[model samples]
Each structure stands twice: as structure tokens, then as C-alpha cells.
Target: MTQENFNEGLLGFLDASPTPFHATQNMAGMFENAGFIKLYEEQRWELEPGKKYYLTRNDSSIIAFTYSGEKNYVMVGAHTDSPNLKVKPNPVIKEHGAVKFGVEPYGGLLLNTWFDRDFSLAGRVSYLDSNNIIKDALIDVKKPIAIIPSLAIHLDDKANQERSINAQSDILPILSTSDDFHFEQFLKDQLKISGVDEVKELYANDLNFYDVQNASFVGLNDDFIASARIDNLISCYVGILSICSIDESKPMLFIANDHEEVGSSSTSGAGGSFLENTLHRVFDDYEEFVQMIRSSIMISADNAHAIHPNYPSKHDANHAPHINKGSVIKINASQRYASNSKTVSRFMNIASSIGEPFQTFVTRSDMGCGSTIGPITATRLGIETLDIGVPTFAMHSIRELCGSKDAYSLYKIILSFNDS
Candidate 1:
């Protein structure tokens, strides 16, 4: 595809995926488009070389790998998960004339951005059937279903820049005014669970409120891209595309894991056995693991903190990464980013070969550093690794910003790495 076409596809993917499930599903579709053969761990185990393969876990994480008898494995990693408010079980409740729902903050959410915005519901729901078999299902109530309206500016005089959000009281979204009791039934109705199943565990599941608005390229010159979940979804998309584009001579893997927002502790997260299990399953022997380790390399893809325009003092003056300047090499003195001199040089070589511009970022000496899956994955597998990402603003905010050119640049660099 042409460069313009590639960017358009990337923007479309970003707009469509607001949650981890959506991100995983979108990437899975792209793999199918690229002619990747789907593989299921439970179905069968067959050995083959020079074939494209993809797999998913808990409908939240995905791993796609390709091989062509090359000794070392080159892997790109990204997380599908993002921070948002999760709907509680038996969420809908009636109080006075208004209907509100209990919401648990899933991760570090910018609670205020959620105010006065149209939001929708999208996630999986599980239920039990006649034979007592558990059935898990996907649901998308695609319309503007709920909203957290802001109290009038008159009520809160300092509303513009100085406002405090109470996560419990201030953020309970308005479901309906007169339809209180029905609101509870509305959730049950959406899940298609019977009202009789009071003893049964009925929930909206991992239901999170998402901005109903679509992601878009904005700015007078159309340089800025705005979207929710851009922090990691952008990397996830690039990783998938890069792996699929290359005719691998080496074992190449793209692992888009879940639950990176809350420290990557879940079973499918970077801290868990998802990658370990897949690696073991692929190598199938102790000797192969040794061989794989000797030559393997990893590129951990996530969003990096770009120098914010409004808050220039927040970032280190000498180490700030700018938009459209190419991928940022993130390092931490605490070993949070897993970058070493040798691995950093290897990535530099890859960047040079592709003629892609690259830069480096380290937190100011006194500031605490943020961690990524790069360090964890590298430590667990003993793989040489480097941390890289598209420079972005609002790293964990509900909606984030990045330069369109930078995203395309990151994709090109990752494509080059995967091709290598």
C-alpha cells in the first residue's frame, strides 16, 4: 500500500479500538487480512516452518508469530489495555428520581475528561445456560448510552482550570431520570440474562465507558492525532502490521498483551506466563530455548511522554522528545525500561539502516521513572531489549494526542526492525 493508505488504515484502527478487547479484535482482523493462519492451542499441535500464525488469550491479549528457519527471534511487544472506569456488578441503582451506577476505576484514569462527554459501553459478558454451561459473549451498545454531566460553571466558580473530581460521588454517570428500576433491568436485558437468575452472578462484566466520539486527525495542518487508548494501541497496531509485512527468515513474534495499565500483573500481562508459555510451546525443548535466547532480541513498544507544550517545565530540558521527530528511546536509571548499551546500539543500527530518525529520553534525575513491559520481558527471557515508542502527550489520560507523522514514522521503524 502507498504511504497515505497506510496512515489512513492506522487512523481507522485507532478510532475503532477504545478498549483492550476492541484493540485485540481489530488486530486479529488485520492478521486475517494479511493472510495469517489462525492457530488454537487446544485444537492441535503441528510443526511447520515458513507459515504465518496468530493466537489470542482471554479475548484480551494476542500473539502473532512467523518463522523461516532463522536462528534468532525478533519480537515486538505492546499492551492492548488502557485505563478507564469499569462498570460494577449490579451497577444500576435508583436513588430519588435519578438513576446512577457504581463504577470502579480500572486504572489511572483522567477522571475529569470524562465529564460532559458522550460515552458508550463495550465489553464481554458471561452467563449460564440451561445445561449449566457457562457462555461468554461480546456486547457493544454502540450508541451514546450514558453521560457524566458537569455541574454548571456558576455552581463551581473555579471550574475552568482548577477543579477536583471525587471519583465516587462526582463521577457517577446519569443513566436516566424516571427510568430508575428499568435501568437495572436495562443492564440485565443487554446481557440477555434472565431476571430470575438473582442467585447467578450477573454483571456488565468488564464494561467500561468510552467516549462516543471517533478519533481524528486535527490541527490547522492536520498534523495532530487525537484518540483514546493511543498510549499503547498505536504500538499494538504497528507491531501487528510490522510482523505481518516481513517475510521472516528468523522466528518473529508480535505479542499484544493485556493489563499493562495496572502494572502488567494479569495472567496475560507482561509479568505473567503468556509470553513464557508461548515461547515454551514454540521452542518445545530445552536446547531450542537456549538457542533462541542466544540470538533473540525484543523491542518493547509503548507510548513515551512527549515534551508537553503547556507544561514545558515538567520534562527534562535536555531530554525532551518532540512530536514527528521519530521514535523515542526511553531509558530509566532504575532499569525500568530494560535498555542497555549493546541493545540500544542494535536498535540504532536498525534505525540507521532504514533512514528513520530516532531520539532518546530519560527522566530527570530527581523524578521517579515509569516502567514498561520491556524490562520485565527482557529479564524473564534473558533477551537483549530496547524500549521505543511514538512521542505522545497525555500518556495515560482518557484521550491522548500525538503527531500523525510520528505514528507513521514509528510504524516504518518497527516494520524495518521486524523485516530485519
Candidate 2:
């Protein structure tokens, strides 16, 4: 796809993926359209060289790979999940005659940012099928259905100075104030319209509320993209789309894990045995599996914080990365990030060869750091991994921002790495 097409496609992806389940499902559609063969974990072996395949776990984590018989496998790692407020099961809490739903912060969320914004509730819900087996359906209200309104300044004396959000009370989204309210019935209705006419018996649900605003170009020259979930979905789309856009001679992979924002300990996360088990199941032969892994290298792409103009001192000045500049090779001395000099140099070479500019970002020495799936994947697979991403701002806010061109650049870099 052309750069213009890439820009539009990325925005479309961001809009379609409100939650990790939706993100994985949307990506699966892309893979299917590109003729990628879907493999089942419970099914037997049918491996072939020069072929492309994809898989999903829990319908949230997904991996797509291609075989080209090359010595070194090029794998791109990313996350489908982002920081957001997730709904608790049976989460209703009626307070002062208002109906609100209970929610717990899903990750390292910036609480204040979500105080006042339209939210569209969306996620997966499990229901008993006609065959008595539980089936899952992704549901979205699409339009704004709820909101977390902030307290009035007149009511709280220190609202501007020291007000703190009470996750239990302050962050509960107002679902409705109608006399009759039933969340379970809402889920049942959602599942019925989710393309399954035979959805019966709402068994359970795993849902999250997201900002209703769609992604769009911002800035006078349209220099930036303002949207939610760009923190990692941008990386996820870049990797998945680039792989789909190219044909590799050697084995290459793209794995977007869920729960990365929450420490990745879930069954479908990088910290779990998903990657190791998949490699073993696919390669079967220990020698071949070892060979594939011995030379394999993974590049973990997640959005890096751009130097915030209001808090520029928080970043390392020398290594501050800006949006539209290029992908930033993120490093942390404490290993919060997984990038090492060797991996950095290799990525630098790849970027330089493709005329794709690259930058570096290091956390301020005095400040603690955040992490991505890079370290987890590197440690889990024992593969050389590097953490990188396009520079972004307001990373965990209700709405995030990034350069319009950076995503395209990241895609080009991933394609170059895949080709190499």
C-alpha cells in the first residue's frame, strides 16, 4: 500500500480495535484476506516452508508468520492491549439515584484524563451456544453510551491542586439513570446483534469501556494522529500489515500479545508459554526449532513517550525523540526496556540501509521507567530483542497523539528488517 493508503488504513484499524479482542479479530480479518492459513493449536502438524500462517489465543493475542528458510528469523513483537478502564463482572453500583458501573483500572492509566469524555463500552462476552458449549462474541455499542464525569470545582476545594480519583466511586462510568437497568440483558442483546442469532444464556463477560472518539489527523499540517490505543495498536498494525504486504524467503513472525499493559502474565501473554509452545508445535524437530530460535531476533514496537513540551525536563535531553522524526530505539539502563547496543546497532544498520531515519530515547536517570513486552519476549525466548516505537504524547490518556508520518516510517523499517 502507498503511504497515503497506509495512513488511512492505520486510522481505520485504530477505530475498529476498541479492545484487545476487537484488535485481534480485526487483524485476523486482514490476515485472512491476505491468504494466510489459520492454524489451530489443538490440530496436528502440517508445516511447510515458504508458507504463511497465523494463530490466536483467547481471541486476544495473535501471531502471524511466514517461512522463507533463511538462517535468522525476524520476529516483530507488539501488544494488542492498552491502558483503559475495564468493567468488573456484575459491576453495577447505584449511588445517589444514579446508575453507574464498577470498573478497575486495567493498567498504568492516567486517571484524570478520563474524567470527562464519551465512552463506548465494548469487549468480548461469553454465552452458552445452542450446542450447550460456551461461545464468545465481540460487542460494541459504537456510539457513546457512558461517561466518567469529573467533580465540580465548586464542590471540592482542592480540586485543581490535590484531587485524587477514587477508582471505586470517582471512576465508575454512568451507564444510565433509567428506572429499569440490567447489564446482563444488555450483554445478551449485544451478543444477539453481534452476528450470532442463536446466542443463548449469558454465561459471563470481559468488557472494557473506550473513548468514543475516532482517530483523526491533527495539527495544522496534519502532522499528528490523535486517537486512543495508538500506544501499541500503531505498532501492532505496522508489524501485521508489513508482513502481509510482503513475501519473505526466510521464516519471520509478528506476535501481538494481550495483557502487556498489565504485566503479561495471562495465558496469551508473552510471559506465558504461548511463543515457546507454538515454536515447538510448529518445528517439531528440536534441532530445527533450536536453529530457528538460535538466529531469531525480535523487535518489540510500542509507542515511546515524546518529550512533553510541558515537562521537557522529565526526559533525557540528549536522547529526547520527537514525533515525525522516526522510530525511537528505547533503552533503559535498568533493563526496563530490552534494547542492547548490539541489537541497537543491528537495527540502526537496518534503518540506515533503508534510508529510514531512527532516533533514541533514554529515561531520565532520576526517574523510574516503564516497560514493554520486549524484555518479556527476550527473556522468554532467549532471542535478541530490541524495543522501539514511534514518538507519541499523552500515551495513556483518554486520547493519545503521534506523528502522522511516523507509523508509515515504522512500517517501512519493519519491512526492511523482515527482508533482511
Candidate 3:
């Protein structure tokens, strides 16, 4: 596909998704549109050589695998969750005649970046109905939903670059006027549940503040994409596309896990039983299961840190990745990433066979680096894996930057591996 089509698809995913549930739903829709079948973990299965199967857990993680007896297994992994704010159970509070909701940071977030930005709330809400049965549902304000306005510029003139944001007090977003101080009642009404007193549980909620602005292609030549969740969503999207585009002559899988940022510890997280359970279900016996996992190679697809124009000194001088150059293979000597020699060579060979341009990323010797789902997944499943990503900047910020030409190239490389 051309860049235009890719951008349209990317932006559409970013816009429709505000929470993990929404992200998975959007992906499931895309898979369905491609005519892939959906499967639940508890469902009984019959072997169908070339049939496609997709599954999800708690709407937080998803895996789409295509099975056909083959020489080897090829898979790609990415995370669906991103860093944002979560509303607390006692989110309702009134101070100085103004009403605000209390929020806590969900993952590693750049607190200052959230200030003065228009935001929204979107996530799963569980409550009891009239029959007293617990029912879960998704709620989205679907507009410029929430805002964390900054203190007046004059109040802290150095705010542009100097002020520190207190996550508890500084980040509480305004909901309404003084008359709106009845936040508990408002929340109960908004969620369509009983009053705080009648309810067995009252959670202000774990809500994130989204940009509410849809992603778009913007550049003098339209060679740029500005959006949220590019850190892993890009990988998730491309992985699914690559798996769907290729013939399932081999066992091809796309595993998108959750909680990568806070460390994948949940049951469906990369650090948990999702991959293991799925693998066991795929094989008939123990020995074959071990063999299958050994023969498989997972390409951990997440965004790599790109060189910043303004701060060129932060990166390793000898190894810097640029936008549109192709995929960046990240190697950490500390084993924080799973890129060993064998896995690295295999990835390079795949990229070379397809003539896809690729690069290497090594953190500067003195600077600390971040981790991805690669090491955690490799360790948990006892499979060889490599770390790779499209180079990007402003990685954990409210908005992120990436190369326009990179997605298509990465897609090509992933397709080559699956086809091979």
C-alpha cells in the first residue's frame, strides 16, 4: 500500500481508540473486515489447516494466529496499552467552590505535558444493575471530554520550562462549575448506576485524558504523522497487517500484550500466561510444544528512540537511527532487550532477503535506557526473540513523532519473514 493509505489507516486507529478496550475493539474490527475468524480461549476448536483465528483477554491483550503445518513459526508482538491518568474511586472533591476529579498516573507519564491540554475519559466501567448483577460496559465522552488546565502563566511565569506539576493537586481536572460540586451524584448519573450510597462499590474511575484531536498527516510534503499511542500501536497495526497479508503456509501469529509500560505482570500480560496458554492449546503434546516454540522466532515490535534534532547529544554517537531509514534493531548489553547474536542474525537475514533497509540502536554508554516486551516475552516462553521498532521521538509524550516512510518499509520486512 502507498503512504496515503497507510496514514489513513493509522490515523483511523488512533482516533477511534481512547482506551485499551477501544484499541482491541478497533483491531478486532479490522481483522473481521479482513475475514479472519475470532476465537475465545474457552471455545473448543477443530483443526482447520488454513483457517485464521484471533483471540483477546479482558479486552486488554489480543493475539491473531493463522495455523498450517509448516517448517517454522513466525510471530510479531506489540502492546495495546499506553500511559495515561486513571480516575480514583473517591474522585469527587470540591475545593474553593470548584469541582474536580482526582486522578492517578497509570504508567510512566510526562506529567507536565498534560497541562493545558484538552482531554477525555474512556475505559471499561463495571457496575450493578437493578437486579444486582454486575454488568460491565464501555463509556466514552466522545468529545473534548476533560481538561487539566494549568495555573495562570502569570502565577508562575517560568511555567514554560521550569514549573513542576504535582500529580495529585496540579493534575485534578475541572468537571463543572460550583453548582457541579455534587460530583458523586453526577458520576452515578453519568455511569447510569445507583447513587454512591446504594452501590456496593463506588469508583471515581481510572480514566485517561486523551487529546480528542484525531491523528493526521502533516508536513510540507505530507511526510509526517502526528498522533498518540504510536509507541506500540504502530507495531500492533503493522503486525496484524503483515500476518493477514501473507499466506498461512506457516504458523503465523501476532501477539499484542498489555501492561508493557508498567511491566507486563497481568494474567494476559507478556510476563504472564497468555502466550504460554495459547502455545499449549496449539500443540497436541508436551514434546511437540517445546519443539514448536524453539523453532519459532518472535519479532518484538515497539518504537525505538530516534535521534532528536535539538538534543543530538543524548544518543550514542556511533549508532543513531533516523526516520524512514527502516526498522531499528535494539541491542542492550544488559539483556534488558532480548537481542542475542542468533536472533539478531536471523532478523538481519530476513531484512536482507527482502532488501528492506534496517539500522541498529545502542543506548549511549552512560545513559539509562528503557525496556520493551521482547525480554519479558522471550524469558516467559523460552523462545528466541529479537527487538525491533520504527525509530521515533517524543516517545512517552502526549503526542509522538515518527517517519512517514517507515511503516510501509517495516510492513514489508515483517511480510517477508512470514512468507519465508
Using TM-score as the measure, the top candidate is 2
Question: What TM-score, over all chains together, does every model reach?
Answer: 0.93, 0.97, 0.93
Q: 150-264, model 3: which lDDT tens digit per residue?
A: 7898888887887887787888887666554564455565566322234445443545667777777767877678887887788888987888787756678898998898999
Where is model 1 more than 4 Å wrong at Cα? 158-162, 180-204, 248-250, 418-420
What's each prediction's clash count? 0, 2, 5
Which sequence of candidate numbers ranks them by lDDT, best first? 2, 3, 1
lDDT (Cα, tens digit) per residue for candidate 1, span 92-196: 768867888788787787787888888888787776656666766666677887798899999989988898988878888777787636644455666664233
Candidate topping lDDT: 2
Residue 142's lDDT within candidate 1 is: 71
Give every collision pair in model 1. none
Better of 1 and 2 by lDDT: 2
Model 2, 56-85: lDDT tens per residue?
Answer: 999999988886655487889899999999
lDDT score, candidate 2: 0.88
